[model samples]
Target: MKRYALQPLVIGALNPESPVSKHRQLRAILRTHAQETCKPGDRLPPERELAEYFDVARKTLRQAIDSLVEDQVLKRVVGVGTFVAHPKVDLQAKLTSYTEEMHRRGMVPAARVLRFDSVPAVGNLAREMGLAEGTPVVRFRRLLLADGTPMSLDDNFIPEHLVPGFLDDEAPMSLYQRLDERYGLILQWAEDEIEAAAATVENADLLKVEIGFPLLRVTRHAYVDDNLIDFSVSVYRSDRYKLFVPIQRHGMRPPRYTKITQT
Candidate 1:
């Protein structure tokens, strides 16, 4: 009654006599197609059409799609069809700036400074930076982007006494680069904490994600020896970014401060 066809949706023919199951065979075909022929956000054909073209039951086709979806090779919307998922970036947990990390991946990095102001350090902000309650601090918010895609919203705070006239300084792409090259504030040690979170309304708007989307919350405390220099909290899109941390046993020397390269 109904007919369906695909020119290049799936490559070659499914091996009916092969040892692999039908769904797995279908998955391999789909995977190959997605990798070779399709781009991220490219939607696959309808389930019925795919099932018919592959000459398999709808259940088998659905199973194959589901497997890919779980692997993040594909993503499905409620009313929308399944689409190829965007590639995720793996950022190493080293003393590296966002600009350096993106450059290592052959990506272009940019930042849009939303607000920069001198605020009185109060409450936890004062205690965190080891500054007096009424001390003035530089607070700036930025939207970090990689290849024109929104990646994170970063909020950084620094004691104004340490960086006097910072607002008048030329805006740089990387804060770490600026601190290292200009101020001789090479950070010797730092701490980073990551947690799972949901996108808030404000965050979602900046990050270009739906409300309540999954996010990775990262907080950092960085210092030059005993002097706290920078404290930051960044919210990242989980679907597009991942943290890569290396683990080692004791007796290994602690990681040292890496020199920031000027770009």
Candidate 2:
């Protein structure tokens, strides 16, 4: 008996006369099936097994798998067979920085400066960064790497007035650490909204995921007191990150009926 259960493969049949290549269609099918059934840390069938099962040429199957890997749907191991990547999570309870989180797990954290440019703020983006409309704001976009492998894209917007001379300061490895040490800026709290999305062309290339692959988009505003300090949008490889929220019960139940307020 096979130890690993054979999941029901759901590859739809190719159009007999469509212009689209069968290899491309196979890639879509496999990607969809993996999204529906596989989570981070799941192992996929070997290339030979997948090719035999699909009755396609090895080249065809390899092409499909390669597409999936690029989209970040699947990841390949060096010597071992490819396994699903587990989504990373924050082990610390207090709101923490990505650099600190990765360091806690013994992973090397590095950032590649993709672009750093200053532009006039406008509309809600300006409001979120606490800049007057048309006021200059600095935008920093980086590809975050863990242990030399790409995992996420961080795009941060900051009001030019808040961090003076920020452009000259080669952003340290850890933004939070720098905020505390250099400028005496203390990061107190942040508000975050998380949603799922497909990797677009830009995100696909930056994250090394296939186009249209699933990802987690987190939009956040970090604040110091009543002033908004930074607005960041982070897109993470869904296969490489798992968001965890712990729930607790206080054993308090709502009253069966509300008591009238006394004057």
Overall lDDT per candidate, in order of appearance: 0.83, 0.74
Roughly what TM-score does model 1 have, to 2 decimal places?
0.89
Q: Lowest summed lDDT over 10 consecutive residues: which window, candidate 2?
A: 254-263
1-263 per-residue lDDT for model 1 (tens digits): 13324354556568888999999988988988888889888998889878888888999999999999988889898897988888776676667788989999898999999978899999998888778889998888899998888988999998888887888875667888888777888888788888999999999999999999999898889988888899998888888876565555598876543222111
Per-residue CA lDDT of model 2 for 43-62, tens digit only, reads 88777776666668899988
Best by TM-score: 1
Each candidate: how many clashes? 0, 10
TM-score of each: 0.89, 0.63
Where does candidate 2 stray beyond 4 Å? Answer: 1-94, 248-263
Q: Which RMSD values do the candidates have, in order?
A: 4.0, 13.5
